[model samples]
Target: MFECFLEIGFEAELNTKEDPELMEIAYEQCKENVATRATAITELRKMIFARGECHPLRTDDEYLLRFLRAREFIVPRAHKLMVRYCTFREQNKHLYEGVDLWGLVKVKDAYEGTMLDRPDTGRLSVFRFGRWDPNEFPVEDLVRAGMAMTEIGLRQPKLQILAGTVIVDLEGISYRHVATLTPTVAYQIVCLMGVAIPGRIKGVHIINYSWILNTFFYLFKKFIPQEAWQYIHFHGSDLKSLHKHLDLEVLPERYGGTYRGVSSFGIWLNKIKKYRDEQFDREMKQLGYVIKE
Candidate 1:
């Protein structure tokens, strides 16, 4: 079975405005954007698992176990509101479910506990004030735990892939109200393998398009040195071929190609360039203040 969780959270510091019409429009727009992204994620998950036999009307013990494990990591600490849009299958039927997964948990306690217990989980723990804290009960951790539980579930061999977009309103204007506006979208996708053998599991693929975009951003920021940190947007269709390079080693297990010395050297050189440029900008900004006699 394939399962996915697409989450969206809003963080904004709006000025005191008395227009109720504008506020209503902003709220509705954000809701619609989130809903559309969630639907896109559901479609992507189905596409990845189309070859497998989907089960309907069956209890997902493995999924429940992973969910519980995730709860143990995030709840009782952060005190932040969380909503989950989950999709899964049982006996040839697709299931869609949503819940306020962290409603009962204390956020602050959970956040501190997760940071202290990082070694036990073998994952990093950190918080982003406005953005979603993926480290605190992230999808990656859930996939790892769920794959391990597949042995006990006796389910068919399958892979669950998740993909979605993150829309940031650049002008502080909600894109949902603009009718034709397309916000800068960042897509992330992860794949988890289903195994029938107990105590043996593998991560077939865990690819996110965001990485490629990051790589490009690094290169551009290093070589181009633009004044503003502009972002590159990607659509769902732009991520189709990310798995091609890893197909041999990840999927079917065969030799494809190899990287040489020059390629390695170039990668390091680019990283150094980017680091130096960033430092230069910081120093220049600090030096801008001066006293005149």
Candidate 2:
């Protein structure tokens, strides 16, 4: 449901100039255009796709590639603005309500490390929603949740060692965060850096589509061959909606723990393992991987 044009415009601006004044104006214009059109464009795309007519944007791969390309332009601009703004505020020692810019950079670095590449601007698009508000910040929630997972040792690689007693708090975190965090903490750190901090600190919405797409891409990049990159896509809705629709039954019984009538990380991890196993199995059937089972 994302638009390619806005992304293209943003990208064009990013590549066209280096002057701070021009960059700021171009970035603001692109941001405004994207923001103004986001909802309508998304809905239109969905409607067109739903009608079963050959939607111009047919696949998630195409959408993601275009989105990433566009973000490559816009994200740097946003990052620069964020850095400047945050520095100014910090220098004045003014109290800011939202996420910290330095925190976002750290998180983005961590995220890129986990993914082995810089996160595209599309991935950091959540910051455009509003002025960064710490109270509404998903980064804090994710950090807290992640810390909790670590505290309970649910984040450990081995699930069978511990029964299903570990509880995962799903409240106050976004679905995008859920997808990223459920992986290794390293991956979670990447997502946290790219999406969560920016969203909180900059008061930008940083479209959830970017997070979902990046998460899939990050996983695929790590576990699959480069030739197979086309298979990855953002699978679901924005973070909040994703959490709402999560199904617990798909996970392994060993990992499934009751948390508000749903599965915890204990269960979620099992599902991820199963997903990996299925992908591996498919790859083995087709390509015959050399690794010993």
Off by over 4 Å in 2: 1-133, 136-141, 155-233, 237-248, 251-260, 263-293
- The candidate that wins on lDDT is 2
Model 2, 162-266: lDDT tens digits are: 111111212233444444434344444333322212221111112234333454345424533343234223323344432232223321222231222222233
Candidate 1, 227-270: lDDT as tens digits? 21232232323223323422212221112212111111122223
| Residue 141 CA displacement from its true place in model 2, Å | 5.1
Name the runs in model 1 displaced over 4 angstroms: 1-64, 71-74, 77-251, 255-293
Cα RMSD (Å) between model 2 and the true structure?
Answer: 22.0
Question: How high is the CA lDDT of each candidate model?
Answer: 0.22, 0.28
State candidate 2's TM-score. Answer: 0.19
